[model samples]
Target: MTQQERRRGRDETEEERADRMWGELIQEVRVAQTGVQILFGFLLTVVFQQKYASLSQADQAIYIVTVVLGACTTGALIGPVSLHRLVSGRRVKPQAVRLASRMTFVGLLLLLVTMGSSLLLILRVATNNGYVPYLVTAVILWYLVCWYGLPLWARRKHSSDG
Candidate 1:
């Protein structure tokens, strides 16, 4: 067997593994939930501002899309918690963890899109320069690198190292 396989937590049963995974997932969800909730709260307030009426039709459309994306992101990030609560007594934690993990992944993707859209809208309003799209693109690339590329690269490298 590979060293990695040997080192895997063979001591833990499926229930224990699920418990450990659930703890880790909750920790991760806490961070993301905080961010999305805060962002969504801010987005909610934007429509109430007087300046909201002054936005161009295109900008208004962007704002609407951004708000919806933020709402969806918030929902996805919080879904795991609700799922856990509803299924706490059932003997389905392993399945719950899997489902929660999927929800978290989807939440992160939505968060990424929400952030990108928010940035695009803000930049578009803050600058009339043609470089707004380029700037947004650069920032999105940076987000991708930080959020997915580095972890995936490490996963690949370390998995191969075993």
Candidate 2:
């Protein structure tokens, strides 16, 4: 049987489906990777700034966590390219694409955490008020709604309608 015979959905052969799916996944990952890499690079430079020395202990902790999360997000977002490079021509394109999608999802989550923590730290340092956490949480909720919730809902709704 050809690759298409192995697939669980539709009539696409493995190669044809992988080719189509990989292209789409790559496009999605490209957008995510660019954003995370830029954010991660910026986070990496923050610690060397003179202003970093004046941050409170809590703020410092948040900074460290944010940076670490950014790094992880960068790694995950870039993982698909390396994975495809390593597994190319091995007849594992479907598996690689599946794994890459998971990585992208994880990277997005990490990016969210990094952004949320960065916001908390900045707002805390800028305002030094009890409302900092509330504001950060609200922004985080917005991110969740926009990034994940809406997309998932739309997908399900569209698919069901189809």
TM-score of 1: 0.95
Q: 30-130 in candidate 1: lDDT tens per residue?
A: 99999998888988998899988999999999999999999899999999999999999899999999999999999999999999999999999889679
Query: What lDDT does each candidate get?
Result: 0.93, 0.88
RMSD of each: 1.8, 4.7
Candidate 2 residue-wise lDDT, 1-162, digit = tens: 555544435677888898899999999989988888787888889899999999988889999988888888888889999999999999999999999989888988988998898888888888999999999999999999999899999989865652
In model 2, state the lDDT of residue 149.
Answer: 94
> Lowest summed lDDT over 10 consecutive residues: which window, candidate 2?
1-10
Give the clash count for each candidate: 0, 3
> After superposing candidate 1, which stretches have Cα over 4 Å from the reference?
1-6
Cα displacement (Å) at residue 75, model 2:
0.8
Best by lDDT: 1
> What is the model-wide C-alpha lDDT for candidate 1?
0.93
